[model samples]
Target: MGPVLRTEHLVSADQQTGEIASKIDAALTQLARARQIQRQCLATRHGLSPLQLDILMTVAAGEPPEPSISLLARELGVSQPTVTAAVITLERKGLVRREPLPPRRTLVRLEPSGQPALADRPFVDAASRLDPALQEAMLEGALVMIAHLVDNGTLSVARTCLTCRFHRSDGGHYCVLLDLPLARSDLRVDCPEHQPAA
Candidate 1:
């Protein structure tokens, strides 16, 4: 016979809620600190805003599709005008260039100047400057939460492992794109190869 279930072994709703809330708060705090560090680094070292840096990195990644205004807007979950504004600012800074396509569309690409900027310290590296254990815990929790939110459609700009087309689950979940096994802890909220599963 199957093992009998025990109601007493289950966690109470209040306990679960408290644990989830605490974890979320801790994760969010760490993420905000990391973002702050990144923003400061970009502003001080590169004379760029966080949005500008994000745009540059997205273009450099070259995933989902080519860097066009519409595509970028959709990927970033921002208005077309917001992306256009950032593109124009980046163009003025000589970091990005817009090439006119047929009809009314334009393609954006990073210029030579932008290449060096992307090589600078990223937030994850910056986070390492803090307490190792704290950083690791915060990042791990944040990744899991973000992945959950993305999978549930609460977050628009992230791609989750479980929802990607390349995800396989024979014995364990794995990504065929990378040809590597995936541990539950290894899942990411932002995988470049992630294609929305049909």
Candidate 2:
């Protein structure tokens, strides 16, 4: 027969697992609530729907090699058509523009009209709702969770050096993938070069 587990030990293990699960659930719930509150405030301040505001924010964050509709859809966890529809609405409002590039790729960027929205107090106030240390902790937790989800196939996006095998934590952060050293603050939340750790 296999080794038998003591009843007391089993009960203790079960209780510990339950407590951890509850804490995770609470954290997720708090994040969801914060997002909802921020979305509501953004909608009220900008006279835009939450989805529109989300699209605008995503587009606003786009750097060179601007984000495509499909990429935005992937990041937002929505259908491309849904993102496209929102883009159309945003275009009508002069908040965003679609620039056609060669070879049939379209790039999305925030228009001048949308810049004012980014500077509004609602976004700042909502962001500051959480304490700075708490926000950093939450972001770190989120990055780790996202890395886990990506490894498990529950999520497909959010590639970061933290999840890459080449990431080294000795003394300071370093990435073998890029052959570059990274500072703690310089660590990217999303990196194109991220290769999942084996």
Candidate 3:
């Protein structure tokens, strides 16, 4: 008898495309759901909207000197006006303050009352509610992604700093980096490690 031959069915190009489209749709749906859940968590426990909470957390995590409106906006991926509005709201609530400082900027810091609200058991417990392993993994992933963005210039490491506005240079040489007076002309220069006055 002649050798028997067998043929297998193959997916058509349209079928393959449909499968990919379905996967993308599912992924988007999950992302939307996750964002909604996070928003609800912030609203229910913190008595603040997600944007409000973000503004508070941003100020809380600022460097010892605190951060200005422009710097905070850059860090939070929002516009200056958006940050300004949040700052105004926080100030009215006595949860933050706008201090007058060098560069003539608005500095933000969490008030004493705000600290307790953020540090309360509910807040801490809500944060702890997430799976530790998952949180760690997400943090690692975010770091890696941020590194890529920085390298690509999609994100900047050099924000407002000594050269930007906050740094007040007196006459005579003074600098941990160059051991010389930093000229005002160098303001536009980018320095990743620049530290501005608090």
Candidate 4:
């Protein structure tokens, strides 16, 4: 028979879980601070605000049916006026263009002239010595965290499988749109093809 857990043992286990959770929270906080610093540095170096850089990065994808001001506001979790102000500045700098769409809506598109900085990814995919399995696990864990954030309204947008209409997972991951099987690594954090599950 298996050894029965006593009250003290259960309490000890609960404490351990809390302690581990605290440590993970602390580490995440450090990462957030580092990200803020990186964003500030990059934004200053390129003569743009952090919000402007983020907007540019989002639009740099150059997807069809270009993002409108309202969509950008919703995606970025910011007010419409804030996004509109940023878009105006970006347009003045020739980094983006405001195109009129039907029914009195304006869409945002990249200028296609300058913006060498914003077009490229800010964070380099640094070489890691971690094993492939460990790396994949890390990626899966991060996506799971992102999904949780989206659920709790900490994040406004996440074009990931968790909310994607095309994703299906009975026991395995698959994409209906592409009609393709998805390995854990095949999952995308920010997919251009993502459509809301609703």
- Show the colliding residue pairs in model 1: none
Give the lDDT of residue 29 in candidate 1. Answer: 91
lDDT for residue 144 in candidate 1, whole number 0-100: 58
Which digits, one per residue and each the tens of the lDDT, describe model 3 over residues 53-116?
A: 7777767765632478888887778899998897888788788888877767878878986774
Which residue pairs does candidate 4 place in steric collision?
A: none
Clash totals for all candidate models: 0, 0, 0, 0
Top-down TM-score ranking: 4, 2, 1, 3
Name the candidate that leads on TM-score. Answer: 4
Cα RMSD (Å) between model 2 and the true structure? Answer: 5.7
Q: How far is 116's C-alpha from truth in model 1 (Å)?
A: 2.9
Any runs in candidate 1 off by more than 4 Å, and if so which?
1-17, 126-144, 175-193
The parts of candidate 3 lying over 4 Å away from their true place are 1-36, 64-66, 116-142, 151-198
The CA lDDT at 1 in model 3 is: 100
- Cα lDDT of model 4 by residue, 1-198, tens digit: 998878755657778889988998898898779778988887888799989988887777665225888888887778989999999998899888999999978898887753676544433443156778877787777877877887788876788886788999877689999999888889887788998676
- Cα error, candidate 3, residue 97 (Å): 1.4
Off by over 4 Å in 4: 1-11, 119-122, 127-130, 192-198
lDDT of 2 by residue, 56-137 (tens): 8777766422478877887888998998898888889989899877787677888888987766445457657988777666
TM-score of 2: 0.74
